[model samples]
Target chain A: MKILVCVSKTPDTTSKVAFTDGNTKFDEAGVQWIINPYDEWYSLVRAIELKEKDASVVIHMVTVGGADTEPIIRKALALGGDEAIRVNSDSTDSYYIAAQIAEIAKQGGYDLIFTGKETLDYNGSSIGGMVAELTDAPYISLATKFDLEGTTATVTREIEGGEEVAEVALPAVVSCQKGMAEQRIPNMRGIMAARTKPLKVTEPVAADALTAIVNFELPPAKAGVKLVDAENVEELVRLLHEEAKAI
Target chain B: MSVLVFIDHADGHVKKSSLEALTYGAKVAAQLGTSAEGLLLGTVTEDLAALGKYGVTKIHQAANEALNNLDTQVYAAAIAEAVTASGATVIIFSHTPTGKAVAARVSAKLKAGLVTGACALPDTSNGFVVKKGVFSGKAFANVSINTAVKIISLNPNSYMTVAGEGTAAVAPLAISAGAAKVKVTAVNKVSGDVPLTEADIVVSGGRGLKGPENWGILLDLAKVLGAATACSRPVGDAHWRPHHEHVGQTGVQVAPNLYIAVGISGAIQHLAGVNRSKIIVVINKDPEAPFFKAADYGIVGDAFEVLPKLTEAIKKMKASA
Candidate 1:
């Protein structure tokens, strides 16, 4: 089985979010970057688990970013990706990125494509479905469990109040979430092997973005917490009704 | 060319979030000097005419059994056909599970620009800039869409639902929904009194609860307050609570009207998943717990002692009302 895992770089959860240039762009200074947790923890780990079960399964990692993103891609390869492909372009629009990935998937003839349900930074959950639409393949979003037998794959996805189990054929797209798999730490042997593995960089296809970022701003600061006396539990309820109106 | 809103339904009734979406779409249409219309993909038990109070002038119902269960492909196909037939310039959806599943597919089929989890109405002064919460609600981004047709998924609980004095004209929609390539074999449901994502108030516990057997107080409090029950990641990891009831960064991200944290230390991951909530109340034995910093109200007390009292107080208040 051929598996393609899409990876992206995100600021560590502890990093302070800020904007610059009249609040028009994200400020990246002094921000520690890591492989998006959804990608590293769920998508790639599940693919590696599949490869562990079947030694013949080959897993490839793909990312759309500038030269700065290669390190994150290398990190994914260290974790267990057999090869890496970097589309030489800054990740701009979701559609453009999805188009580039669709082009690669078409050329590579990958049977299974996996991505984090949504990128942590943009929170755009549109790419995997868009890629699936472009490729004319079945797509499952927020998949918590996946099992493959021959060409058919059984998947479980979170719906309104429960989980729906579904079956899809090969050459499908899946956006993975937490229940899919656990995180894997790269061993010294895997790190050494990743250094020698193939890392291919290619130019992106022609695509135009339909949306532009007008500005970026942080949410309003939270108010100081009001500590109610434990004995005055009624005071808290009264405030919830009068002040917060949240009751 | 009117604003079209997708009315999501389950158990034969329209979801509350969908009503909010309808009101938002109507507000947008009123801003643009046009009317708002709604499209129902499946059969619903409610009176379609009564939905006009949400400000929609027309309701298009497609009562196909295949449409009852959500299939992104089938929904996208049917909605795309509706968009073409209605000549809708803008489409609105509630940023719930169904919206997240189908909006992108419809956007791809129509080559439309989509903004998911939009927290505010579009600013039409310059062009069309929609403000959305990004980075797990830690920040906001104003996105400018240049496409002729635009699609937006409004965040749940972000907007208010307003009713007006109007009645809608219901009409049957003629469209064919193709068979889905992905087949749903079974559905395993959580029997919670309130759905976690749709709940207005969420009462969550953490490792401080100690074991699964100690969950009775939390459930009792949730039941008295008419809230949903959730747990932190560690509690779910320890199997003291089911994974579906977990609400954190790696778990379910919920933005309820009121989020009460009991026995939770509030790690950054946990906060990331819930910071968007309107009001946060923390109850912990440790006064130095990090969750207090983000909470609107804090009570440093033992959960074992505080929970029952709070539940009793809420029950008393409800009984009086």
Candidate 2:
């Protein structure tokens, strides 16, 4: 089985968010980049687990970014991906990114495709469905559990207020979320091997972005907290009802 | 040249987020000087005509039983067809699980610019620009949709649901749902009066609660306040709470009117999921807990001592009111 796992580089969760160049570009200075937690902890780890179970299974990691994303892709390789493909483009538009990934998936002809439910940066949970549409493949989003037997895959995905168990044949796209797999750390030997693994860079296919970023604005800062004495629980309740009007 | 809103429903009732989307779509239609319409794929028991009070002039339904359960591909195809037939240049969705699954496919099919997590209406003054939360609500981005056809999925609780007096004309939309490739076998639903995403008030516990056995105190507080229960990532990871109740960067993000954090040291990830709340109250024994910075109110006290008193006080306040 050949599985293609989509990964992306995002600012570490703890990094302070800021924009530069008139808010048209993210200020990357002093920002620590890492593999998106959803991609690293869930989607890629699940693929590694599948590869560990089946000796013939090959896991390939694909990412769309500029040269700065190489380090993150190498980290994914250390986590058990056999090969890596980098599309040389830094477009943040969801459609443009999905189109590029779809192009790779079409060429790879993989039996299964995996992506995080959404990237940490954009929070646009749209890529997996767009890739599925572009490739004419079955799609499932927010998958919490996945199992494979023969050619069929059973997935448990989160719905509105519940979970739904569904089945689809191979050659499908599934976007994974938490509970799909546990986090894995790369060992010294794996890290050494990842340095020598094949990292193929490919130019992006010509695709027009449907959307563009006009500018970014910071969220309004909160006013200082009103410290209420724990002994005066009634005051807190009263404040909620009167001052905040939250209850 | 109309604004079409996708009305998402479950168990025959329209979802609250969809109602907000309908109102938003109506306002957007007014901005564009066009009419607002609603498109429903599944069979529903609600009075469709009464939804006009949300500003929709008409409700177009396909009325297919297969559409009841969410099939992303089938729904996308049906919606694309509806958009083409109705000549709707603007499409609106609620950004719920159903909308998340279907909207992107529809956008891809129609070659439209799709914006998810939209927090405000589009600015049509110069060009079509929509403001949305990025970096998990840490910041906002104004996105320009250059495509002729545009799709916007409104984040829950971001827009107000305004209902006036009017009845919409219910019309039958001729659209055939395609065969579903993904077959659903079973469903497991969380049994609760209020779903966390739709809750007006959310009471969340964290690792400081210590164990799952000690969850009763938190539950008591939620019960009195008529709020939904949530937990931090650590609490969910430790199995103190179900994964569905976990609210964080990777977990379910909620923007309720009020969020009360109990025992949780607010991590940046935890804040990402909840910073959108209208008001936040943090209760922790550690005065240095980071959540206090983002909270509207703070109480430096242990959960064991503070929660029961708060619950009792709220109960008494409610009884008196």
Please give the CA lDDT of all the candidate structures: 0.89, 0.92
TM-score of chain A of 1: 0.98
For candidate 2, the per-residue lDDT at A245 reads: 91
- How many angstroms is residue A157 displaced in model 2 relative to the true structure, after the best TM-score fit? 0.7
lDDT (10s digit) by residue, model 1, range A16-83? 89988999878899999999898889999999999999999999889999999988887788899789
Report the lDDT tens digits of candidate 2 across residue range B256-277: 9999999989999999999999
Segments in model 2 whose C-alpha atoms lie over 4 Å from true places: none
What TM-scores do the predictions have? 0.98, 0.98
Return the number of clashes found in candidate 1: 0
Clashing pairs in 1: none
What is the per-residue lDDT of model 1 for residues B192-296, given as tens digits with 9 covering 90 to 100?
A: 468888889999999888889999999999888889889999999888987888897777889999999999999998998899899999999999999999999
Candidate 1 chain A, which ten residues in sequence have the lowest lDDT sum?
A90-99
